[model samples]
Target: MKINRCIAPLMISVILSVAGCSSSSKEDQVMNANLGAQALYDKARESMANGNFAAAADSLSALDSRFPFGPLSHQVQLDLVYSYYKSGKIDQTLATIDRFIRLNPNHADVDYAFYMRGLTNMEADNNLFQELVGIDTTDRDPSKSKQAFDDFRRLIQQYPDSKYAADARQRMVFIKNRLASYEISIARFYMRREAFIAAANRGRYVLEYYPDSDQLQQALEIMVECYDQLELTELRDNAMKTLKLNFPDSQFIS
Candidate 1:
């Protein structure tokens, strides 16, 4: 009986040790979590270089969680933004950039963060119908374009000497033109509907807000047409005279 009891205890001990060994390996396989932040970041960069944005994001996110206050935290956030953008996680990208900007407003790379924020909105606001079907649906709401324009404008104003300033300025011009053209389209639509007052107001808005836009002459012509349709002789005549003075050879004047 003593011999049997000793043998039973030995068997139980072996079984427990074996179970512990299995659990350790199983835990490693089940989680597969990286141990070191730097190593994980290096792996993320390697994934990024190979165009594996999904994996790169995963590694970056892991590193971020594990080492939020680490020296590479900001860089990880920036890289994660790029990775999320590449992987089409636009919301995540924007959120990441915004957090970075809020946290590191005076960082050397803050301009880049602002530029990326603008780019994100610009891409989001793209006229997909116009690009894909060659249709000019300019009457759509310009809210996204306005947001992008604000972001780009802030970047330019705050970082005039930044490398991204020139591009931000150019994008602002494009957004302004788009917004002006959209206002014109709305004005013309109102005119077709015989809502002459609304049409005139829209034209005036374009003229006042988008003076430097290419649509300036069109705006003047729209105001002239709407005022004439509404029998506002004085306003119509004033708009016509201004158009003639500013654009003597404009097709809109005719």
Candidate 2:
């Protein structure tokens, strides 16, 4: 009723300042609501549900960083593995899976971890030609393929009753057959170069290591051709006879 002008202005300024601070605080909270591990984890799952794999991977990574030993640590890591795979982070997927398998060997979902590991390795990039025609894989690095094969084999042997066992067995067969075919490619390359001895050695490697593969028939033919080119009569005749015995209608027998 009798306020001085100076006092009234000062009071008004104070109220305005307080109101600004409250608004700013609420805004900050809203902006930072996703900083917590639980929030980030939920966001990651939601992103995954929507097929936003890249966002899911980022959120899962944030969750892992924020709560390394939190209640959801194991699940976060496991989810990160899947998110990384779906987002095409092949290296990250493989590394996360290996870490999971090593740290949680007896975990209930260890079989799934192995299966994912195999899938990551199997999906690793190969030579362009190999990716298309599936030849010359042996000429290139076969390390990942071999690793994937072993991973699948281990999963099948260790967890025969696992839900993933059937798929693992099928993948193992595919990898084994591909490996055998790779050997045949190598043998064929050596033959084209007229390196008969080298071709024969490759053929022998396939026959010895992949006896059950479909490429075994081609390996026998390679041995026969290479032995003949090298003028090894005894080896050539033996290979020819084996080829005839195994593939009675083999076109190369004559």
Candidate 3:
């Protein structure tokens, strides 16, 4: 009986040790979910190359979480941003870009983040339905356009020598034109409502801020009409002179 009791205890201890070892090994396997950082990055790259951006985003997100301190971490984050953008996940793209910019202010590719942010905001404001239906959006809210303009402006000012600077400058011009048109639309609305002072102020705002916009002539015309309505003869004459000076063939000139 003594011998059997001693043997039973020994067997139980051996079983517990084996079970403990097995559990430890499984935990290690779960902890090191990935084979290695390089292999996972390669997998993500392959997914991206296959045009499977959702899969690529998933893989890249996993790699980012698993190997945040790895040598390829920056590149991984950039790739993830691209994946999110290509996947049409604008919110995620913007959030990831903001996080990247905040975390890597001095990174060599930080300029890319700014460029992507501008592009994403521009995309967010693009109403495909309105475009297809031929609905004019100039009078609509321009909050996203304003944000995109700010992003591009910051990129151009802060990274003048960046490779994307030229493109940012071009986009800024387009945004300025759009914003000018928006102001003109509001001024016309005010004119229709008989708010001559408000309309003239909006026109002046366009001239002051968007000098090179394509809507310069329209702004001047609005100013002239509004000032005349308000009985401001001097301001009306000044707006007319400027309009004739700039646009010799303006309808308001004759």
RMSD to the hidden true structure, all candidates:
12.7, 13.5, 13.9
For model 2, the superposed segments whose C-alpha errors exceed 4 Å read: 1-33, 126-139
For candidate 3, which ten residues in a row score worst on lDDT?
Answer: 26-35
Among all candidates shown, the one with the greatest lDDT: 3
Output the TM-score of candidate 2: 0.81
Q: Is candidate 1 or candidate 2 better by lDDT?
A: 1
Ordered by lDDT, highest first, the candidates read 3, 1, 2
Model 1 root-mean-square deviation: 12.7
Q: List runs of model 1 lying over 4 Å from the truth.
A: 1-32, 127-130, 252-254
Q: How many residue pairs clash in each candidate?
A: 0, 0, 0
Give lDDT tens digits, candidate 3, residues 1-254.
35587689899999999999889757644544655888777877887999988777877887888889889999999999999999999999998999999999999999999999999999888899999999999998889999999999999899999999999999989989999999999999998899999999999999999999999999999999988888999999999999999999998887
Query: Please, what is the TM-score per model?
Result: 0.83, 0.81, 0.84
Candidate models: Cα lDDT each: 0.88, 0.85, 0.90
Which digits, one per residue and each the tens of the lDDT, describe model 2 over residues 114-167? 999999888883555565975545566677889999998899889999999999
Distance from true location, Cα of 233 in model 3, Å: 0.6
TM-score, predicted candidate 1 vs. hidden true structure = 0.83
lDDT of 1: 0.88
lDDT of 1 by residue, 1-254 (tens): 35587689899999999999888756643343745878888888998999989778978888888899999998999999889888877788899999999899999999999888888887777766688998886777888889989998999889999999999999999999999999999988898899999999998998899999999999999899889988999999999998999899977666
